[model samples]
Target: MRRELPGLGSDPASVRQRIEGMEQILERMFVVPGINKPVGLDVILSLIPGVGTISAAALGSYIAWEARNLGMSKWQVARMAGNIGFDMLLGAIPVIGAIPDFFFRSNTRNLRIVRKHLDKKHPGSRTLDVQATPGA
Candidate 1:
């Protein structure tokens, strides 16, 4: 419905929408169970040599930017970065890395962190106001 954030009008709504879309992309593209054993995009792309893994890392960086925009602290951002770094490092090892990607779901983890921080910054920013009124 209405996605405004205080006085920011539609700007915050646009950002929120983008973040939600990105989260969906991460979840559907990498986290859902599939007929092919549910391997994630990170591992599947890693099979393409240098470019593939790098692309995955780039996507991770985009998530980091969104996290920052969502008011996530530097420490939290660092943790997400470390997770992606670890994914890249471990994903370098042939078949083992790919399998881990299927289970790791780093994108999903980062998405949750971003959503949490955003909600903390702007309560009810993305949901209906169903909580009891203070006077009621």
Candidate 2:
């Protein structure tokens, strides 16, 4: 039997969920101890220098690729690519790179672009936000 991947469906809803999950993993997987700010693989991996930055870029590019598959305009995809490129440049810096990576959040930005496009063109794919009550 073949093992199926999660969120690999070609439907817009599946794509939206997939990209959202990726953005979450790349940009907000954990909270810093004292700072309490969320940080993800993008920031952590970027500390490894060349290979890490490239790996993050590749993962970021996957979002753009999904956008392209959804028939998003070339200009929009280009903008997403530009965001990733700029992020890679920042991550290339020594020591200080992760600091900027912590702030910039290219994957989150790309997710915003993708969400807007999906909301506008594929409204049915939109996911609702549900906040939990403090003591419920």
Candidate 3:
């Protein structure tokens, strides 16, 4: 029997959830001190010079890969790949790499692309956003 990993489903809904979760982990996992901005593994990993940038790029590429798997058009996939490539280049710079990586969230951009596609092509996968009431 083949074993399926959690969050690795092939359905559109599953894929949507998985990519959203990944984007959260890669782009909004933590809050920065003082500046009060959200950051995630993408920025944090890019701080380790060579290895970190590569690792972060690889993770970013996974989003593009998922986009391709969702039957997105070649142009969209290429755009996604371009986003990841540009991010990788930005991250390759030494000393100040993480600064731009913090602001330019390639994974978040890709997630937006993926969500657009899913919303149009797989409307059934649409999920409602629930926000908490202030001081409720």
lDDT of each: 0.66, 0.92, 0.90
**Candidates sorted by TM-score, best first:** 2, 3, 1
* TM agreement with the true structure for every prediction: 0.69, 0.91, 0.89
User: Per-residue CA lDDT of candidate 2, range 39-118, in tens?
Assistant: 99999989997999999999999999999999999999999999999999999997689999999999999999999999
Query: Model 1, 1-136: lDDT tens per residue?
Result: 9675554443445556665555455434543446534344566776766677777777766777877776679999998898778767766666666666656767767767766776777665665425345579
Residues 61-92 of candidate 3 have per-residue lDDT tens digits of: 88888888899999999998899989999999
Worst 10 residues of 1 by lDDT: 30-39
Q: How close is candidate 2 to the true structure, as a TM-score?
A: 0.91
* lDDT for position 48 in model 3: 86
Clashes of 2: 0
The predictions' CA RMSDs to the true structure, in order, are 7.9, 2.7, 2.4
* Candidate 3 local lDDT, residue 20: 89
Between which residue pairs do clashes occur in model 3?
none
Segments in model 2 whose C-alpha atoms lie over 4 Å from true places: 1-6, 131-136
